[model samples]
Target chain A: MLRFIISLWASKLCLFLFKHTGRERDDRPGILALRLCPNFLDRVKKPPLVVAVTGTNGKTTISNLVSNILNLEGKKVAYNTWGANYKAGQARCLLDAVSIFNRPTKDAAVVEVDELLSYKTLPWIQPNYVIVTNICRDSIRRNAHQDLIFSRINQGVSKLPNATLILNADDPNSSFLGENNNKRFFAIADQHADVFETNVSDFPVCPKCGTVPVFNYRHYRAIGNFYCPNCGLKSKTGDFIGTKLDFDKREMLVKEKDGEFKYPLVSDTIFNAFNIMAIITLFRTIGYSPEVIAEHIKHIKLPENRVACEDLGKIKMYTFSAKGQNVSAASTVFEYLAKEPSKKELILLLDEHYGDDPNIETITWLYETDFEYLNNENIKKIIVAGQRYLDYKLRLRLAGIPVEKTVCVFDEQTIPDYVSTDGIESIYVLHDVTTVLRAKKIKDKIKEKITNQ
Target chain B: MKIEVLYPELSNLYGDYYNAKYLAMCIPDSQTVFTSNNDKPAFLSEKVDIICMGSMSERNQEFAIKHLMPYKDKIKELVDNGTFFLATGNSFEIFGDHIEDDGKKIECLGAIDFYSKRQMNDRRNCFFLGDFQTEKGEDIKIVGHKSQFSFSHGKATEKPFISVEGGFGINLDSKNEGVHYKNFFGTYILGPFIMLNPQFLKYLLRSMNLNDSLLYEEEINNAYADRLKRLQREGTEFLMGAE
Candidate 1:
């Protein structure tokens, strides 16, 4: 116990030093604590209720939403808001809530865990509920493929005999995790939206019979209500179902066995709707009333770091944090842009910045992404900037975008100057996670230029 | 010409389907048939000018081996007959003798002498720059990325598709990268290998007796040259083994 306290204090001191030294507050402290005391996570007293949100995407947003809602309901919560989601970061979040005596002061903790790190994290945290938003193909170098991530998560969840899993029934890869475990599912009903198929799909064949699964309707990119024709295997009937998503009104209806509830749509995108639905199901399971969830959720806006819009006089500027090396996330942003009924100019800053490394290999994730969405007629001009700008230009041209409309800049700093702000109602800046600060700087320059004009 | 992409739905794990797409772009009139795992490969019935297969999950690799095992003789016959076969990433491992995952060993098609062994926790990733001798007696530079959990072992009877100039080859110790049996070209390199290496693609085109150049030849070649130069400077610094 004495050794554990000493390690905890040392971690706190490290964090204090990091803050004072103007360094980013990350998982380094938690890692240091673990190094000092290998069983630091086990030594600390866990919160009364620990909910872990994990998956390939939406983990950060879901974790944030759950934490925000719980806080609104007057419950103290600890979460990793900086998007540090590995085991060390999770340990840091837990340590943040505890006193020096090692007793947790918070009532609950909403932790965002990386899919692969679940095996290292879940055993120590012993979360009461593990919400897997959805699992899909992520970065080829990091994730490999969806199946490998699924297996890792499965191995982790198998060790959690006391936890119930919250899964996405629409995602076959993630829903498969619910097998042989106490699990509840959340699914979005057929929205009747146009399903534009991509060249690749993560789950085209049925896991059980190795046959092509028959889909009643596809939401997007192999996520849908699917059943195997050979073995009669189908998507599990979700306990919580989101239906009648009215994007114009920004609202969706959630139906449970007992009754139906309406919640303000978090974002226009279906992915965000799924995140909202998952959080609702979690809050409902935790004994929060439907009215409380609906009311509080409206106040919880989407994170500005990811998706934010600002009006600079007549021109509306939008910024989306498209994760570098993630095709699905980038595709989602493009899809959202395509649906907007306005003439727009796009600024693509999708390069994974490897600071001062000129020899860094060009990422292949660009080819996997569907740049065809940017070929929409409404997009008047595209300004692609950064290290991988040439690669982006080539991909965009292959996707059938006209060379005249596309402009390439080698450096991100010149993006604002390159963007043509003429005869366009809105300007969209799509930046990667690592280059968000640069995106903001570019946006400011554009805003300044537009204001002067 | 007819190009058959075997089990594309299962095998297109990386952006490797772009290889087939680029091939189609380069040869506008050619029809590319994407064969699903459930259906029999089109190469079984009709004449296929080229057959391509890409990366896939380890579990799906097992399924692929099982699905292709029955047609092993046909594949061997096709290879001997000098039909062009391009297998990228882990897809090439399916044609090998066997794959050992953890403690379980699954038998492959045995089209090659080597065997693959996968370590669940150890995934090796690297940027490769190499040269291969074409049938025209010209050596061309090949640049591609490799991210895999498994590595192949054992001596290959035939010449390798690409010689290791920078990164680790077939295994950590071997300089031979992949197998080239007649017209069958197999490599662990991913990233739409043909698209990244235009010179290699041109060699492939020459082998097919096509006079056509690559689509966006200038840009593709420029990218290839730039990548090759960077790889030369880095000198295996970007090459990372299992963690």
Candidate 2:
């Protein structure tokens, strides 16, 4: 008990110092607390309503939406707004919610937990609601495979019998987490979008009958309405189903057990739509009216740096961050870029940034990614840059992209020189998540090139 | 030439399927057969020039072993006939004796006298650098990555695949990386090893009695040189797992 008190007080002092020193977001206090008290999360007092949002892709956006909506409703919500979703960051967020005496002061807490580390962090936090967005192939070196991630998350969620789970019914891997636990599933009604053909998917065989399930309506990468002919397993629109997506009007209709309610779609991307749906399902389960949630959601927008766009006089430049090692994320971005009607030139800054460093980056994700999408006639010049330019050139060649259309520049600085604006109305700059700052600088260079021309 | 890719839907982990793809590109007009878990493998009925299989999830590994169990005799016969077989990542475990996973013994095809033990929670991520002697009697450096949860153990080490120079082999203590008997090559290294190692790819092509000409030879060679120099740098950590 004395050790726990000492650890709490010391961690509180560190948090206080961090705030005073303008380093409040740093997770050092949490690391120190965990080192001092191995079970600090279990010992510390938690907020009344603790919610955990976990998945491979949209956990950050969903948690942010949930936190912002609650804050708009005049409820104090604590969440990790930064990229630190690990245990140390989660512990730090929880520590910030309580008093120095270890008493809760916030109305609620929305924590974004890493899927791989959720098994270790979730049991301690003991959230009231756990929302699994979706599971897909992540970094092979870290996550290994989706089954390992599913196993870890399922183990963690199973321990919380009292906590209700809000799941994405379209994802076969994460939909069936805990059988006996309370599960509320949400799925989007198919928009009849073209089913993306690729070499990547992780929707495993039916657990009961050991046969592949049949998808009545397939979305991108194994996300859709699926059923088994051999067994009784099928996807259900359990509590909430998102339908009638309108990217032009930025609106979507969500149907619940009571009635259908219209909600404002925060972003035009399908993944962002799912993120909004997950947030809506969460707040509605917590007794928030749809009108109130929709009104607050209208003001909530994605970060500017995530999908920044600039008007470069004649051509529009869309600079966005795509996850490097994640195959599904890159494939989704490629599919989106390919569907755009305007003639575009792609400046790919998507290589792993640490090639020059001591640690080597894996190129396996390249083969898994659908670089073939860049082969569209609308996409004119593909200026491949960075240390892995040769690798990208080889992959693009194998994807049947004409050699004349592809330009490989060994130096990243020379990429803008290789990019041609002729016969192109837009330039899409796809970068790795770690290379966002570098991408912004390259975007500026390209902007200069176009304006000066 | 016909190349049979076994269980591509399941064995397509870590992008190692590109090995077969790269080989097909190297050898033009080669018919590539992608056999899924639901369909019977093409190698069962036809005499494929090369049969390849990559890694997969543990659950799918069970399905693979089950699908190939009835043809264990055929596999043995093929091995004795000196048919070229390339099994990368954990797919190598499917042809082993059995897998000891968390005190449970999952039976494999038992074509070889080796057993793999799985570490469910621990993943061994490492950079592998080894030597592969070509059919021309020249030694070529093979560079690849290993992101696996299990390693095989047995007398197959006597017929070691690539003599380890830097990274670990069957296990931490063993210097032998994989099993090389006849024309069968099984390694835990993931990724497109053939794409990364041009000389090794050329050697592989030549051994299969095909022209050794490669696509993007200069670019791939440059990449191999750059990666080799980096992996051999002083203070470069090879083992990427916690003790």
Candidate 3:
């Protein structure tokens, strides 16, 4: 009750500021709503086709895709475009959905939920459709272990039987939710894709039965075919299965209701397929078509900057995905280099917040990936410069890495990704969870370095 | 190959057998023996390749001395001949000469230059940095967590055991993967080894000559790889303190 009252006051305080100064932001309306009612979401209007997408990866992308699909069909979508996924964030989103007189509206509210808070928000807004993006060991520093993560996700999904649950079939644990079949849909990737993750294996085995699960195919970040020999349960055909059109070409072939139907997608890679699949399937159930989805792609870009292009003298260069806890990005890096060898130096950064945490030990699993194991001898030197510089030095060192091919540059300023003055085509990796403004800052720096030089 | 993992209630302290499960995954055998000191097993001497000890079950003054009695002499002999053992949490110290938990002094097996105490959960949840050696004679750095009051002999140890830093490696569950003699190595690395690190599993499989164990190595490893590449990249930033 006290929390409710405090929340109420906070909300009013936010509203007063916005009303007086006309400086509206994401949090103010939510503060006002909390002031109106602590259980605002529970009492607020919920659309019939509401879908909540949550997980460690792919939440933002997935949320956008779903909203785009709905908008293509010319339906209203009340959402948080800022990726404000907390309870207050949702309240703020609801506030935006309301008119000046304040009435709940929208054909569907495609919501991205923070993984930790999904359970807390679920009861308040028991979504009619819930999509689990994928499950990897995320935030053990802030959350608990992997098993606990799985358990918590299970808890969240278990609460919504009346809702349609769409899961990532490629993810063993996440796909397992499909077996329950409380009207759930699953998305999977096909094996024929030229793209493949070089690294992804090395998650802890199931404590229930020690027998390691089998694998049919893997699509980076531990999202692929799997089942325990002892358990005798392998992931089967999910209601919504995804087969990548090409590993290199980033196109996804969507198969719904087993293999009875298939369709092509513009989004590339199984990871993106997951995001696209969630939106297409749920909006289709809510009533949208491929052509409707195709309409949105005309304006959308595949979460650019992950493989964004930048000018470096006469050479065509791009900053590849790195720095995040993304195996797919690393594997893609391997795929890029292997498909088209880069003799030029690749500049990678390891910031303290992203990779410096010694709690960041699982990074060693990179050794198992085809990248390090296959290309032990590759192009130019690997610049290892980060806060926990020695940790990267040791991780690379232990990979039986050729010391001559690697250079440890500890100070951030010393890292090559900082500048393109030398006309070097470089790949600067970035982690996923970051202030977008910081990414924009880095992007600006990259732009200035290349253009100014 | 069957691996025996004992949840030494007293010596199996802090349920260090989770670390044993980790080591067992690195071994070739499917059979594992897990017997806690609170419930000592009778068939402990029958060709058991690995024994995992947990730390103190309860926080008390005379924790180590009371818990490590059953396998005291046997653990020492196993270490001398190189039998693999995992002593995590407070279990690492029960094998030590003495452990001062709060105000009590308890004697232990004196295996490594280590001792422990019973603090709150401050030692309970913290990540550590270490290394594991493969048969190919390469050192593999490992990062796992521990929550106990034990400390290691040195800041670092042998191959397969890298020196760890910038973590919660204080007087608590010293991130030690114990000494490796012959086939015997010990440490506080908890949880499923084969599942967490495929290198350790690969080492165990190759050592045990079980190529069959690697049937799904590519796929399983690919899954981990996908996650790890990001982890390593992020780890670089994390260890770099970029965040």
**Considering every candidate listed, which one attains the maximal DockQ?**
1
- Compare candidates 1 and 2 on lDDT and give the better one: 2
What i-RMS does every model get? 2.2, 2.5, 12.3
Q: Report the CAPRI category for model 2.
A: medium
Model 1, residue pairs in steric clash = none
Q: What lDDT tens digits, residue by residue, belong to model 2 across residues B30-84?
A: 9999886678878888889889998888888887898899889899888879899
Q: What is the TM-score of each candidate against the true structure?
A: 0.96, 0.96, 0.64
Ranking by DockQ: 1, 2, 3
Question: In candidate 1, how many Å is residue B50 off?
Answer: 0.7
Off by over 4 Å in 2: A207-210, A451-453
Chain A TM-score per model, please list them: 0.96, 0.95, 0.79
lDDT of each: 0.83, 0.84, 0.53
Candidate with maximal lDDT: 2
TM-score, cand. 1: 0.96
* CAPRI quality band, candidate 1: medium
Residue-wise lDDT of candidate 2 within A1-453, one digit each (tens)?
A: 888888888998998999899998799998988889989988889999999989888777788778888888898877778757887888899988999888898999998888998898889889999999899887887788888889889889989999999999988778888777898888899899887777775664665555667888866788888898777798866588897899989999999988999999976788888888888888899888999889999988786556788888778998876777888888888888888788998888876753365567778888888888878989887887877777777788888899999998767888788888877899988887778878898899989988889
Candidate 3: share of reference interface contacts reproduced? 0.03
Residue-by-residue lDDT tens digits, candidate 3, B1-243 = 556555332332222333444444434545776553344553454766555554333332143345446667776777676665544444455555665656876676776555555543233344454556565768765555443334544422323243555244433344334545455444554433334456655665456456635533553465445334544453433222110
